[model samples]
Target: MSTQGLERQTRNYLSNNVPQIQQHGGNFEIREVDEEAGQVTVAIGGACSGCGIAPMTMKAIEHRLPESVDGVSEVKVVRAGGPRAAVMPSKIDEMDEMEEYEDYDPPF
Candidate 1:
């Protein structure tokens, strides 16, 4: 099949079979599709950036894409920005300040 056809098939397979991706506010982008090598590169983006389950998601894609998409012998899934460190209030004063905003309505 042509490179474009393979890419479309891969995308369709993901869209239809992978519900978790979209359910978690995440999306995958086909970064590269090498027809001769039968390799595909996919990047997970959006809320998946710092998601704990991202590694499992990638593994699932790597394992399943090739089985479902014709001409795809290998799959590589990566995060768009990698995982991010979560930030939180570390002190009581900061926590109080945060609580203050809980009831403050925005002007907008």
Candidate 2:
């Protein structure tokens, strides 16, 4: 498939698959899609950035994304801003400040 075709496909895949990922509390963004080399780099973000299970989130994206794009050889992640990840949260420890709980009775 053409590179443009691949990019479109990749974008679509991300849009579609992201909700499934979010349901599990993982969030990510696509940083680069290299159709020539058949590689995709994703940046982990949101709660995923500080979660202890970040690797699991990365692996989940790596495993599923490639299969969606045509001619994808592999998924190359740059993490959230580390040597690998890009644009990582500046203060991972401060994430607790984001939590706000609302009690609700189940409709079911």
Candidate 3:
């Protein structure tokens, strides 16, 4: 798949899933996407930054965005930090955390 195709897919996926994201007062903007490499980077803006639901928004995007689109092995979110890098967490590290919690016995 070409980069353009991947970007298009990512856009479509966002549009289709925007409602869900918006319901939580969050939004995402595509920065760049590479199809062959299956990499996508997006920016989260608006109320998402200060929202306590930010984690949910991030988790939802990380889990659903790639599955919703083709040729996307992973998704990266970037918070608007001007010239500096985005404030989003590393995808690999986030995935590792998710995996760690996937199977567990809560000591409640």
Best by TM-score: 1
Q: For residue 38, give model 1's deviation from the true position in Å.
A: 0.6
Which digits, one per residue and each the tens of the lDDT, describe model 2 over residues 1-108? 777787778667766765644665555667787777898777765556656445544556567777766777798653465543322455543433333311222111
| lDDT string, candidate 3, 6-83, tens digits | 888887877666665556555678888776679899877655554444455565677777777877888887564443
Clashes of each: 0, 9, 0
User: TM-score per candidate, in order?
Assistant: 0.73, 0.59, 0.65
Best-to-worst lDDT order? 1, 3, 2
Point out the worst 10-residue segment of candidate 1 by lDDT.
84-93
TM-score between model 1 and native: 0.73
The stretch of ten residues in a row with the least summed lDDT in candidate 3 is 99-108
- How far off is residue 11 in model 2, in Å? 2.3
Clashing pairs in 2: 78-84, 78-85, 79-84, 79-85, 80-85, 80-86, 80-88, 81-85, 81-86
**lDDT against true structure, model 1:** 0.72
Give the higher-lDDT candidate: 1 or 3: 1
**lDDT scores of the candidates, listed in order:** 0.72, 0.60, 0.64
What residue pairs are clashing in model 3?
Answer: none
**Whole-model lDDT, candidate 3?**
0.64
